[model samples]
Target: ALIAAFEARIRAQPVHVAAEVQLAATAAALPPLSAPVDEEAEAPAEEAIAPRAPQEQVRVRADLLDNLVNHAGEVAIYRARLEQQLGAFRAAMAELDRTNARLRDQLRRLDLETEAQIVARYQREQDSADPTFDPLELDRFSTLQQLSRALNESAADLTGLQGVLDDLARQYDVLLQQQSRVSSDLQDGLMSARMVPFDSVVPRLRRVVRQAGHDTGKQVQLRLDGTHGELDRNVLDRMVAPIEHMLRNSVAHGLETPAERVAAGKSEEGTITIALRHEGSEIVLQVSDDGRGLDRDAIRRRAEQRGLLKPGAVLTDTELDSLIFEAGFSTSEQVSQLAGRGVGMDVVRNEVRQLGGTVEIHSVVGRGVTFTLRLPQTLAVTQAVFVQIGETTYAVPVASVSGIGRISRERFESGTGGYRYAGEEYALHDLGLLVGQGPAKAEGQAQVPLLLVRAGDLRAAVAIDQVVGNREIVVKPVGMQIASVPGIYGATITGDGRVVVILDVAPLVRRHLAQRPAAEAEAQQQRHVPLVMVVDDSLTMRKVTGRVLERHNFEVVTARDGIEALEKLEERVPDLMLLDIEMPRMDGYELATAMRADARFRGVPIVMITSRTGEKHRQRAFEIGVQRYLGKPYQELDLMRNVYDLLGIARARD
Candidate 1:
């Protein structure tokens, strides 16, 4: 009956009644319900779930991280300085202890002597039967007794102080060790935070290769290995442009067109590979291309046209390969969007150098070319060798040093123009002179310590006044004014609180090679002369000595004192030296000792002639290896005999 009523209502108002009519019909077709359910049967759900654990990592602003790194590096520098200071303090304590022991021994001797004198006086008074001679008077305070007692008390106090100082030194040492460990950990953590994977720049590198191949109308494939390798974020960011430039160069210059490759029996597609890996403390990156290699003839012609090489200049293959990095040097015939403006490789070299790194080229003319870049694992801190060149200290990156040795000043000036090590000849350079520090004071040492360094294909032996030992240094940037200076890469603070310049070896080697030809020519011309050096403060003495040597058919060099003589010795070594004992700056004895210690001048006989003709002076001169000692107003014949004997030459006809 309800379904019929709903149907009649739907016909009256079809749109509104349709849903009600359908509900009524469905209800009429269903079976009857059994029972109603209870509301209590169902349980309520929990209002909230357990809270999630806090995030373990959070992003930090780069500048904030960089500032933290700087602070940590400062802490490290302070720790190193504190360690040195502690060592110095320990040495002072040891000296103080020795001084105290000596003082106590002297006081004991004084006390004993005073007691013996008092006993002797008492015995003399008693033996003479003097009534005023009292036995108690012997024990009474006298000036000598009082002085001895005071000395004994002071010595005892010094011994107590020494014990306290020793304890304090030990405590300080413990503290310093703890600080060192903490500083090392903090630096490592900060550097690790700054590291980023190599794949961070892989996308951009691929884009560079793709775009370059498209523009050059060549088929090129980019392959990457060791993408998981890591570098400091700052280093990776700076390397992007340089790596991109190399990729473009390989595509434009290294690869051949598809048709050309096919004709040459190579695959139609060319491959360029970028490999990254860690080598010891450095990160090595290599960009290589398997295609038509560098055209040696084309590069040679360009070098000639650019005047970098003389026409028909004879050069080894390595030497010729290095010329491509010269600024504004290119072998491309026509200027194009990709190349021929002559700008890429030099910029690449400069960028790599700025990062405290080195770049090298390995190419086979028909095979291919590979560019290798070796960079510090991190820019924040690096291992460097500190060397004292003059009053100042400088740091050389350990990565650049191949070996260290001591070369006699004689061997350096032997007109060989270089030092040989491991069967290879390396050009020798004076670090003090190269940096405009003038000649370093020899400080009585005979041999100069030198570092054998390699920069790319170039090698040189850099002579320094002393090796200050190797250290891990925090690198700091110099201001814009100093940054433009050649051969200076950056600055570091030593443990002694001195700011040392970190040398860029590549630029130094380049500068040396650039000036080598002229230096060699000059050395050749002066090598034939038997040079005699006269060192005296008196103008008349120098003039008379020079005149005698000149008359004897020998070349003469004169210096006002030992300092001047050392400076002149840089030019050439003399066959024999005439030294005066009383000259200023550096005395004759000091000079002789220094010369005898040095292997270069040890064979050169020295004659000391001074106004002070005492036996003591003569003995000291002979002890210092001076061959002859003469008093003032020496006989001319005597001087000539000694000179001729030392030179191993026969006397000339009178």
Candidate 2:
């Protein structure tokens, strides 16, 4: 109406003023409404203009959503087929075992009954001389003879029936086992088919993290690794919204503004690292930030004031951390609806957990915070370690291995004081005390084996009595139970018919050390010795020795020629030496003789590292006696272990 009124007035006005307004309006037209607009948006229009049309809802065909629903249901088909085949096959085998046992018992009973009848007849025949005195004796002997014949025939008939039943039982057992195997394989193939790469869900979201920071005037850096890991296709597609919410929370709430971050000695562009890895039965995803961690004490105060927590409540970090997931936990009213309504994370956690996964929280007071998520692989044969817990058997995967060792009570120490090993120190946690199930009765002192595992770049040594070899077992998920266990990924049955609980190293290791003292969090280098430098002219010799030393945890450094060898020797001195024969710049004998003559390297151990198809090298090496002698490509473990033992680093840690 205003534009029409102005046009009527302009026609009556001077021509020059009307021409300028007309030209300006033609250039400006309708305004764009993407970001915030300045004076340009509300300025007087130079020409007649129209507003933007409203966006359409884009109606999708019913069949598209139907197809999505159908695809989701397809996953259950494989699961149903697997469950049915396994269940039926197991039932059939059980029936076979029972039938075989029943048949065998029946045959044994028939045999005993036949034997008793025979014995009675024999006794009657032996006493027949006295029976001749009476006519009744002859009649009794005839009756006994008839009973013995009947018993023998009955026993033979039962034996024939038992043989037939046994054959049928064996066939059923074999058929059931085959069906179980085929079903497991089909289920695995189906699962893998449903997996979609994780990046697909978050590709556009990566840019959102940056844009969120820009809008809020906060600087942030996004780091993503292992984006190649996969999740269910539909689940992956729906994941963008939840993850985007988290990213918003991170920029607006978790990360400090640029000025604040800079004052705290952090980079202006705060770092957020996202990682994904497959652990046993599941895919472990982590999103962490080098920003302000969770404020536990603050959270506690709020909870108490709001009556969410009772006064003087004693709660663990794990329990306190869960308060963030409570419904309506959001405290920031002026904030955008992106996150922190306490509702967003709850939805995310529920959606993931419903898919057979769990979420956890870990933070450092000064450094940063991490959110850990565990999602089952769903489509592949997961590696698992099978062990017996109570009456049931379970498996745990080998990827969780820290290292294996043995510790007796004499070697065990309390968790407080630091223990020394290999001229270094380490804090210890007695495995028996931690598990609460050491042994009913241990013989030959209280000794136990240990396994050292890594969690988020941190290491912990755990103790166990036995080490089962690695296996690829089909993961069977248990509902509700997975939520309660911090480290469990899934369960699997072993080839030996034992059930094993697969342990996820990330959570298991973290939980193991979660309650312990801060000293236990020290670097693993204290338990590990320094790297050793080995120099040899032969390529085979260098690789062979390096592997041996490395297996024992002595970081091995090697060189192939004398020029490179000498340079390394000059830069660093090794714990021990293996001088080789027939080299370019120097030979085995010459290097050894030179080492003994040099004052700086005189104390170093120099073993005769050679392969001379003869005893001459040995005789010459003995003359020096600087160290022991070893042949070329010698049994790797022996030589490296000997070096470890000599360096005082071979002893097991408690």
Give the number of the best model, judged by TM-score.
1
RMSD of each: 15.9, 28.1
Q: Specify the poorest-scoring 10-residue window by lDDT in model 2.
A: 436-445
- Residue ranges of candidate 2 with Cα displaced over 4 Å: 1-144, 234-240, 296-301, 310-320, 339-342, 379-654
In the range 1-654, model 2's lDDT, one tens digit per residue, is 445555666677766676757754764564533547666755645322655567875555545654543443344344444555566656555545544455555556765665566556656766655644543344544454565557657656766765676677567667656765775565555555566688775668778887888788887888989988887665565556667777777776688888888899888888888888977566787888888887788778867877889989999776787777666676454656454456677777766644445677888876878888766565235454443322333455554443455555555533344444334333454333233333211222245444554332334555444454555555556568564666556665444444456655445444556654432443222242455667676555677778767676666777654556566777666767666766656666766777778786778876666677477768877786546777766776567566766676645653
Which residue pairs in candidate 1 have backbone atoms (N, alpha carbon, C) closer than 3 angstroms, thus clashing?
446-598
For candidate 2, the lDDT comes to 0.61
Q: What is the lDDT of residue 357 in candidate 1?
A: 85
lDDT (C-alpha) at residue 263 in model 1: 88
